[model samples]
Target: MEKFEQIFKYVNEYAEKLVEANGLDYLEALLQTLEDTLDGTFEWQVEGANKEDMRKAIQIAILKGMRKSAQPNHQMTPDTLGLLVAHFVEQCFEHRLQHGPIAVVDPALGTGNLLFTVMNALNGNVEATGVEVDDLLIRLAAATGDLIEQPVTLFRQDALEKLLVDPVDAVICDLPVGYYPNEEVALDFELCASEGMSYAHHLFIEQSMNYTKDGGFAFFLIPANLFESEQAKQLHKFIKGHAWIQAVIQLPENLFASKAHEKSILILQKHSEHLKAPREVLLAKVPNMSNREALAMFFEKVSMWREGNDQKR
Candidate 1:
């Protein structure tokens, strides 16, 4: 980890130097530096050291440093929550081998942590794409992809304005928190007719659902109080009409580095006439412990539920 930090620091310094010397854009300089140094910076001659290990190290190190230096986006999913969300996605694909090599998209992919984690959990058998409004975060995410030799298409467009032409297998995101001040952007009138547009997170969740194919999943880490908020009643009503609620996992408070608000991961499957919706949704709460025990327990519970479903079929 220490070595990784050193490498990341060197890369940062190199990018800054390039910016100063060439008068290049920050993102362009960083991209150039990453392309030139990724191979040499992580070269490890130690026995059993492989490109995969180097790639993981580079991703973690750069992500840690970038998070520290870059302007904070409270909307970004915390690492722990992101990992758990990724695991849930992997579980969704466990029994569906026919869809083995699925597509996962993150509409608000800050640093691409959740997106890449999902790819890793699936053992690199999936295609990953992300759309981020922030240039710096997207650059760092692209650099990580370059290092790992993994292809992840990142669009610079705002997620609110961009709609997917081709639906995907899963829509996974840690929605941007707080209200979206833009009232001009057209939204589902039903979501706004009752309470008007309140939070941007609500719109993002809707976008996630819309991005998924029939019978596909959309997972979001959102404010735990969302369900109780008066402004969200319309959002819930809209969801009831269009999607099947699958699971709601409450996360521990302070799981995020920026905010301590209690959060939850909501899993929804887009409305599908051919696939029957679950009679009862899974609602699980994780204890506030930082250990991996809580995640293991959650995984076990989900596995049991899935197995029961298989038996019924």
Candidate 2:
């Protein structure tokens, strides 16, 4: 851990230097730093470091840069939450893993942190795709993938825009909440608000479902009050018509600054002839992550639910 801290500190300092010297934003500078590190220009003894260590070093550097930039939308998914999501993904797709590498996509791929975290947890058994509209973020994501030596294909466009990608086996996202601005584009979506700006998160769910292969899974980190929102009825109807709600795992509230900021993981599997909805949704409220015993029990419950559902199928 101490060694990783040293690596993070060096990377962060070098990125800061580039930000100052080139008058570039911290994210852009961080990308350049990662590129330099990868090409041996910024020389670090990372040859012997494992991929997880390298990923962590890059993540820490990105977090520091985000704090310096102070952009709310630039926030990366917290590592703890990302790891938990990865655990859920691994268990949900355990059957698929036995066959071969699975295709995965992150529509709101900010900095590629969540996607890469899962990729690392899965140990390279993923064909990864990332979609983002921000130029710097997409570039940073690409560089981060290259630095970590993960093969990630990235698309630079609005995630809601028509993607050339084929349906993938799994979808994962830290859903971008708030109203979607493009009303004209919103009109094409069934979840579009009847009289006002449509919730981007809702539309993203719909889009993700459309891009997922039948029987594939989507794991989303979403606002805790997602179903209590103004557009809940429409969103609920859409989800019911198209997918099976597998679980809704509320994250520990203390992880956020306030109750309103708390989020949950919503796991859904696209409808298919071979699959049916779980007998009961696995609704859970996670304990404070520091409580090892409580967390273990929580995951055990999840495992049992998964096993029971699998047997039914």
- lDDT of each model, Cα atoms only? 0.71, 0.90
Query: What range of 10 consecutive residues in model 1 has the weakest lDDT sum?
Result: 42-51
Supply candidate 2's per-residue lDDT for 168: 98
Q: Write candidate 1's Cα lDDT for 1-313 as tens digits.
A: 4544555566667767887899865555656767676657533233454444544555654554544454566134445776787778877777674556888888997767677766665676778888988877787678867666678888987787756536888999887877776666635434543445557888787777778898899998888788877776778887898898888988776565454476788999898877777766888887766567866786789888666553122
Q: Model 1 — TM-score against the truth?
A: 0.82
Best by TM-score: 2
What value of lDDT does candidate 1 attain over all alpha carbons?
0.71
212-280 in candidate 2: lDDT tens per residue?
999999999999999998789999999999999999998987899998789999999999988767788
TM-score of each: 0.82, 0.96
Candidate number of the best lDDT:
2
After superposition, which runs of candidate 2 have C-alpha atoms over 4 Å from their true positions?
Answer: 311-313
Compute the lDDT for candidate 2. 0.90
lDDT accuracy of residue 151 in candidate 2: 98
